[model samples]
Target: MRRLIASTFASLDGILQAPGGPQEDPTGGFALGGWMFPYADDSMDLSAAGFDGKDRELLLGRRTYQIFEAHWPYQAHDDPIAQSLNAAKKHVASRTLSTLHWNNSTLLQGDVVAAVTALKSTPGPDLQMIGSGNLIQTLQAAALIDEYNVWTFPVVLGRGKRLFDEGATPSALRLVQSRVSTSGVVMSTYVPGGDVQPGSFVTTEPSERELDRRKKMANGTW
Candidate 1:
């Protein structure tokens, strides 16, 4: 069985949109594109996360695939990042795109969840999903991702697409590894733990004040 890993760059506010460049994604008039550039430093080597010396495949959403297809192919073959991306097979999850022109790329068949599940069952290298927010949300909803390599930059985008938006299914995750780059990027790896265990800080039974507050909340009273 192959492990499905999702790697993404998020802001302090959990916004995952347009970290690369201004033209990358400007939908909804997102003026804060390329918010991650200022934090870049020599210590930031993403290959350490999962990009090097691994048997992996690329799983991408349509927009991300388009972004990569336009860029990675033009990079020099000697570049480690470019080499890995160029040589690895890519699977695209896009309902609207009927065809993919990128080399070594194939469009996923049938439902995204079912297809990805079947892919995981086959004997192969781990599947790495990169910068595909929409696809990531779908896979996350289905609980299909096995690992998450997240790099949280220091900045925050007040409004943009987010990593765990409202309505995302709740699940638990255990941090297996973590590191901080010189630029203050928090790089962490996590694996799905299980269902979210609920607990509370209230030590004893609810006091009359708390109970009344709960009642008011339930009744939608201010």
Candidate 2:
């Protein structure tokens, strides 16, 4: 069985929308499009390059799929990223789209979680998902994602779509690798660990003696 990987670029505050360009997604009054452009560095290049060598197919949401279909096909053949994205078999998750214009594209029908779970069971290279916040949320909720590649930029966009939202089930992750870019981007790879173990450290009201000790310590009278 092949693994399912989700790769996303996000701000410090967890906004994942429109990291590519201004027009990429203007929904919900998101003004900070193309926020990740300035932080591109050699580390980012190297991280992207590693994925270039991997045998993989793409899983995208409707919006992201349309964006790639419009841009990648027209890009020069020598552009490595374009070539890889255009040539790879794309599986798009959408309820409205009936026909896909891009070559070798498949529309996932019915329950999104079930369809993706079935896809993960198939033999192939890793199934990669990029820049699909909605789709990623569904997958994360289902616990279907096997790996995550997150490039966390330094800047914080106070509001936007986040990679992990409130609806997502609490889960633990184990960091596989991490690196910091010259531009202050923190790139990290993680794999699902298990269920989240919730714990906290707090004490109830102190006893009389304990309170007296605390007061003495505060007043330097211990």
Candidate 3:
């Protein structure tokens, strides 16, 4: 089965909405749409991190798909990013959209989970989800995503769509690799590390000797 990877950008406080530009997503009156622009630098290699549509097929939510369809295709003909995105096969999940006009774009039919599960079993390149927060949440709840490449910027937007919302499954992650860009962006990669193992550092029930020691300390005797 092919792995389903999520490559996304988020703010310090976990807001992941509209890292590209202001007009990307303004729903809910999100005034800080373009908060990630200031921290961008050349060191944040998009291609090396598997964020640029290099070898994987694209899995996008309706909103993200709509955003890309309007922009990438209209870029300069020789633009590498546009070329890759324009040529790659896109699997989009949406309940309201009946048609998709982007090149090599197809809609997943019926039950999003079932469709995606079937897609994973079929032979194909690894699937990559860009900035589809809603889709990410769904897949995350289902534990369908295999890997995460989260680029956390320095800024914080108190209110906006986040990468992992409260509805996200409670699970621990193993940090496989990490690096910081010159512009203070922390780009990290993580993989599932089983369930969320809850632990505590609080004191346990004390023994008789421990209790005596505590009593002595309370009385300033020893």
* Per-model TM-score on C-alpha atoms: 0.95, 0.88, 0.91
Clash count for each candidate, listed in order shown: 0, 0, 0
Task: Encode model 1's per-residue lDDT on 183-211: one tens digit a residue.
Answer: 89999999999999999887899889989
In order, the Cα lDDT scores of the candidates are 0.89, 0.87, 0.92
As a whole number from 0 to 100, the lDDT of residue 181 in candidate 3 is 99
Clashing pairs in 2: none
Over 109-188, each residue of candidate 2 has an lDDT whose tens digit, in order, gives: 89999899888888887798988899999999888888998889999899989998899889999999898989999989
Q: How close is candidate 3 to the true structure, as a TM-score?
A: 0.91
Model 1 poorest 10 in a row by lDDT: 46-55
The true-versus-predicted C-alpha distance at residue 65 of model 2, in Å, is 0.4
Tell me the spans in candidate 1 whose CA falls farther than 4 Å from its real position.
51-54
